[model samples]
Target chain A: MPGKTFEEQVRQELIGLRLEPSQQVWETLAVQLQQKHKRRRIFWLLMLMLCLLGASGWWWIQHNTDLAPGHAWTTHADNSTATKTTTTTTTPILPERIQPDTTPSTVISQTTTIPAHQNRDKNDYAGTADQLPVKLLNRQAPRTNASVNQSGRYTLPVGNHQKSALSKDLQREAVPENGVIKDQKSQPIPAQDNRIKQSVTAAPAFRDTVVISEDSKKSVVSAVLRLPPSDTTATEKNTRSADTAALPVPTHQPVDSTKASVTPATQSAGKSGWSWAVQVLGGLGGTRKSIGSLFAAPDPLRAYNPIGSGSPGSGAGSGGTATGAIPVVRDGASLGFEVAMEKKIGPKQRHLLGLSAGYHFYTTQLKVGARTAGTLLFNNFNVSNQTGYYFASRDSLNYTNYYHFLEAAVQYYIPFSFLKANMRWHTSLGINYLLTSNGLHYDYSGNAAYLFQNNSLFNRLQLNTGSGLDMQLGRKKPVWAGLQVDYMLGNLSKQALSDQHLFRISAILRIPLQKPARK
Target chain B: MQDEKKLVKDCLKQHPAAQKQLYELFAREMLGICYRYTKSMHDAEEVLQQGFIKVFQYLHQYRSDGELGAWIRRIMVNTAINYLKRRPQYQLDLSFEDAHLHPVDNHQPDLRVQMKDLLNLVRQLPAGYQTIFNLHAVEGYSHVEIAKMMGISEGTSRSQYARARGLLISWLENHGINDKKDYYAR
Candidate 1:
């Protein structure tokens, strides 16, 4: 026989070898796999949410762009003067209360020609003579009694003079009878005469000027005109005025008793009002047992040595040196829900400060006896100080500790730079007063001994700092979805053997309660 | 084959029953392979656990063209190699030159030798010899492949395997097993 047959025989025999593994292997594997599966599910779910967020934002942008076609309704209107020469159409910015109707019946297309003298100071006028006669079209206006010519044009009677003559021309064409302009349908257009009367008095120096308000500057013009409308009720007009009253009124313009409103062209400008949001978070919370900077917890069963002794591994804690005596404490699930009313403050309205009230519960599990007796320590006087609790058991059992807290916190948030503009980092600092359970309690089950709980040791006041990388979704009303990691600065227990501080990592979803105002 | 494809599809869907079924099907054979590479049963089981984890994690990448058992066996072999590299003791043993130790015994025993005896005889070789023997003689890897896997030269792999086989043959002879009948032809 060839010498290779030995190798061949060995290969054949060994390849068919089979050995059964212990059950512990599968049990551990199952736990790890479950965690992996959970992480994977969370990851995919977040990705799906992000994709939906992107899609919704895209749809919103598309929808708004379609609403006012071809008009350059710029957000940075202050710096928009340089590009004004190229813009063919410029309209007076409307307050957020006006939801422009797109019906063709209400569409008003007006071409206003800026006189040559007004275009001389480029810094003041922003547009060249070539950019004159800018066509103003309201594609979203509601169906009204505003008369249009055969070609769908609402011709503004041109004049050689300034603001007063333009107002007089408008008054001559659409004359008010008994303070109300009646449509062709003989329907009364309430407040139409008052708006024209107010515009005539409050109009600025330029006849056809597009005023851009800088971040630092209060507005100069507040001439928002509503022509004769058929369907608009008097109550609706009053409501619209009331909504505008909350906005910053330009000091330069005379306040019309009927309506005095100013439009802040950007989202940053509109963020001054209080916006409430509800935040829901869920994740893992654990106590970090450390002395000073080192994470070494003093071993409770340091004196016990169980090696070479008849000790059941499951019944009693494995006894060895100080390292082996360290107790196993598994972190439990943490969940919290809070409702907060916050306002954007500081420069550019980028920071947020708020007050929040919520409920949170944290749990931790330790393996101990089902029922044990041990020395108890309490803040109050105890006559029977000889190991007050029952002890002496070798049975291993899981004891879950629950700490429930009614949290009242003052939170402050600041922006942080991240990978993408859509994904923003928010750093939050909170000073919290949490009513907690009597901190960590001890029980001597078998070889395991010592505990950190005393009634006086529990500290209800805690301060925490947390940060999250949020994916800001939607433009009209944005929602923030992100992962937040929080660390408590103060220990939950006072005068404990180990310095026990809590830390948690959670997935947070924050939804704003109000829609942001837009121009 | 269709049942296997369905099992794989179900496993990919994260069905716990399907996962457990798949683990039960291959775990015994996989554990045996891990045992041959490690010093103790505990180490073998640890490697088996790690290997099974990788199997489930990258299960989506498995194509139905090859046999599922063969694919899983390949993963187990790779995992065993990694486990050996991770531990300092095994790392020391993996040094082929330093691990060339002489056999301690030359006792003559009964003429009959079982497969269990053969396995114990193979385990007596140093870690380098045992790994090379298992990879070449049993796992059917080429010397070049073994060198690449172990980060050694092809010549070292060949020498290790030869020494491993010689030691096993000498132990078999000492145990009074006839090479022609009990060792190879059986």
Candidate 2:
């Protein structure tokens, strides 16, 4: 073991150096917290609407998967029960059949085989101008039943259904695995009289068939496909037969809109999974005098010298005046909001965490001992005793409203590793780093006079609470309402009853949304 | 409070809990290792964090046949040495000798000190000698292993190891604790 002698002692020293930021930032953070609550409500409401829209879209997709032959498909096989038949022939390719998906994937089998050494010419991979005129031949339009040489790359658009018909003929013409080409059906279709589907754009997709199961009463055929490379010419693509025996190759080219038949893509995209939610926190921390402590009313000291018309009601008679040698306690209350982002981890199970930073934005009225500001000879001594000093702290003389705050946080979602049932709970422990806060100085017009701030030492405790209901939407999605609270252990000064630390609360709502994963 | 099997399992998963545990358990020892390799405390921390992060990322790759903490400690020492390797200039100018502690005569015994005192003396040695002395005397790695680890010849490692031990013993003898037991003698 190393550093054995110094580890504990050094760690203790380092721990003492932690940064506790200032509390003057509470005003900005307080306002931001309030805005956050409003935004969260709006967010959840929008999330709900988005979820409804996405769910409707997903339902529409799940139920509307078309099995028609001309509907298009790009890697579209996953527990799908659609019947697909692909034909290979030289006719102009279908123009409106391919809807290109932007996701990148490695399609293993979409390759053109070349003789080992003929590829010796670097140009073989990208052939020379004389070797293959893809530009000229491709412009010649598309043809069906066009025979490509066994070893040579085909440059023109091989008509769609013709590829299917030609494969049928190829079973008779060429022997299996032998690389032998029979000479029939080798003629290309003419440019002017092309009656095939117009394939203006071609995606490098190869469709292959594997027989899943076969019975006299039930026949199951599957076409496993991948998105073709975007560069390959339409004619160079081939349609191969599932078996050489005797099944007809159906000419199936799905329409453009049919490309996104992947179920998870549709399922993930049905609804917004997190909903917008909000919570409000309010507290009235007050002080009371026991009846036993102040049972009798005492005589008034000539506390107010009222020689003028204002002399009568200027005594110690406010809304709350506890009479006793016992300490007087002033009560105050604070309001705040909490907003959050939530994600579901399991079926009917959701884990959510929220951050809410706020404090009371209270208006202050300062009083000096029996004297008002800008006083001369008491404006003729009669009303001199009737006056009380009313001055905001020099620090807050211009804008005298006090606000509070806390901000920026990160949460650890612990429920992601397990499959919990109906329990939408997540407990996270993190530091609520407070931003810089402001103290408003009040002028006679009540504008901000100036601001000086420091981090409240007592603001460094855990603000812990839970909000949001665990809602189960549809069959799988989970929705949770958001609620949260914060507790700081510090308090303010003497004449005021509370400490420097603060507490806050808020709520949230989660809605399910869609994620388009595959097409 | 470390569990024998469960600790290994949790470490393998790179759980943050396991990381905190590893830190609490070995930070002291690793810091000693680091102090032997580096000139300053801050540098030692940098090396420690680097080594610990590597140990965590590769925890799953641990084959369960060996002691888990030992395996991680080896990684830490290597990481510390690697920091020296990248800055060859650190080794190039490593010529600092104390001129004041020579020609000591009598012996004063400090019987209150034990293994901890000797370890502190090892830490106060210069980086090169401290690392070699600790590896050979405490860690029990062979000269060949030390050579491969520090990217130096075995003879240099041998000579350095001998010199480190001689310096430690000489320091103790000068401190007046002459047991003549070759007590500081590795």
lDDT of each: 0.51, 0.36
What is the C-alpha lDDT profile of model 2 across A1-519, one tens digit per residue? 233332232233222221211222222223333443454585588568546755664564343222222223221111111122222422121222212222331111113231223333332222232222222121111111112233332212223543454334323332222221111222221211111111111122222222221222122221222222221233232211111111112233422222211111122221233322332344432211221222222111111111212222222122222111111122334444444444333453333333333322222222111112442222212121112223322211122223444443434343321132222334443344433333211111122111112223123333333222232222223333445443333332211222223333334343333322222
lDDT by residue for model 1 (B37-78), tens: 877776687788889989999999999998999999999999
Candidate with maximal TM-score: 1
Residue ranges of candidate 2 with Cα displaced over 4 Å: A1-519, B87-89, B93-117, B174-186
What TM-scores do the predictions have?
0.49, 0.27
Model 1 earns a TM-score of 0.49
> lDDT by residue for model 2 over B75-104, one digit each (tens)?
877888777665555476334333333332
What is every candidate's C-alpha DockQ against the true complex, given to 2 decimals? 0.33, 0.01
TM-score of chain B of 2: 0.70
* lDDT, model 2: 0.36
| TM-score of predicted chain A against the true chain A, for each candidate | 0.44, 0.27
lDDT of 2 at A272: 37
Alpha-carbon interface RMSD for all candidates, in angstroms: 5.2, 14.0
| Backbone collisions counted per model | 7, 93
Candidate 1 scores an fnat of: 0.63
For all candidates in order, state the fraction of native interface contacts they contain: 0.63, 0.00
